[model samples]
Target: MSRKTGTLLCLIAGSMMLIIGCSKSSEDRLTTPIPPSDCDTVNMTYSSDVQPILEANCYSCHGNGNVNGGVTLDSYTGVKLVADNGLLIGVITHAPGYPPMPDGGGKLSDCDINKIKDWINRGASNN
Candidate 1:
C-alpha cells in the first residue's frame, strides 16, 4: 500500500476507535443508585422532600399547565398515579426501558433521589 493510503487508513481507524470510546456506557446512561451520606432518609415525606424536588426539576413540563406526555405532577394525586404505577421511580432512576425524568435536565441529586426512594419504599404516603 502507498504511504499516504496507509496513513489515511490509520487515521480512519483511530477516529472510529475514539468515537466508540466516547460513547456512553450502559452504566453511565443509567442514573446510578447512590446512597446519600447526609440526607436523612429515615422519615421522607411527599410534601417535605419529594414535592420540592419535583417542583424544581419536573413541573415545567409535567405540571398542571403542561401535562406533557399525559403526566401531570402538580398535585399529590397526580404524583401518586405515576408513583403507584412505577413510572415515577423508573424515570427518575433512569432505569432501562423508561424515559428519564426532567427530560434534558440533569439527573436528581443522590440526596433527592434517595429521599424519593425512601418515601416510595414507605408506601408513597400523602404526608
Candidate 2:
C-alpha cells in the first residue's frame, strides 16, 4: 500500500484498539472483586460482640449451666470473674502455662480476639 494509506490504516487500527480498551463491556466492568474485610471492632460491647463469641466458642463447655473447669461465661458475673483475674486474656491468647481455649480447637479469629480485647479494655461491662 502507499505510505499515506499504510499510515492511515495504522492510525485506524490504533484508534480501534484504544476505543475497545476504553469502552469495556458492562460485564467486564462488573468485576466481582473480593471486598475488604468488614471486621469492625469499634465500640465493642459485651452483649453485642463479646457474648456472641463466647456463646459460639465457649458456651458448650463453660456456659448453659455446664461451668466446665469452673469457668462460667454464660452470664456477665461469671465472665467478669475471669476478666478481672486476667485469666480470660491469657487462656484465649494461648499464653504460656495457660491452656488454649475452645478445648482442642484452633485459636479464635483475629477479629473476634480484637473485639474481646476492645470490650475488656473498655472495662468489660455488662453492656
Candidate 3:
C-alpha cells in the first residue's frame, strides 16, 4: 500500500474506534448496585435518608442562592418543592419529563432510586 493510502486506512480505523467507544449506552457504564436501605420498609424521610444523596450529588448548585430552575435541595422543604413539582422523582427515575439528576454522574442504583420514590410516594415527609 502507498504511504498516503495506508495513513487514510489508519485514520478511518481510528475514527471507527472513537465512535464505538463514545457510543456506549448508559447501562454499559454503570458498575455499582445501589444497596437496599432500611428506609424501604418504613418511611424514607428527607432528613434521614434522602438528604445525604442530595448533599453528595446536588448541593453544589441547589443548596445556595444559585438554585437551578428556581429549585433547591439543601433543606427538606426545598427538596419537597421539587419532589411535589414532580420533577425530582421524574429526574431520578429517568422518566420522560426531565433530564436525569447529576447530569453526568452515573445513574443512582435501583435501591437508592427506590428509596426516593418511596419518600415521594409517602408524601415526601421531612421527618
Provide the TM-score for each candidate, comma-separated.
Answer: 0.69, 0.71, 0.63
lDDT for each candidate structure:
0.89, 0.90, 0.79
Model 1: per-residue Cα lDDT at residue 27: 47
Cα lDDT, model 3, residue 95: 86
Identify the leading candidate in terms of lDDT: 2
> What's the CA error at residue 64 for candidate 2, in Å?
1.3
What does candidate 3's lDDT look like per residue over 39-64, in tens digits? 36357777777888888778887886
Give the per-residue lDDT of model 1 (tens digit) for 1-127.
Answer: 9999999999999999887876756547666766556788788999989999999999999885998999999899999999899999999989999998779888888778888999989999999
lDDT of 2 by residue, 37-94 (tens): 8888888999888999999999999988798888999999999999989999999999
Number of backbone collisions per candidate: 0, 0, 0
Identify the leading candidate in terms of TM-score.
2
Models sorted by TM-score, best on top: 2, 1, 3
What are the C-alpha RMSDs, in order, of all predicted structures?
A: 11.5, 4.3, 12.2
Least lDDT summed over 10 consecutive residues: which range in candidate 3? 33-42
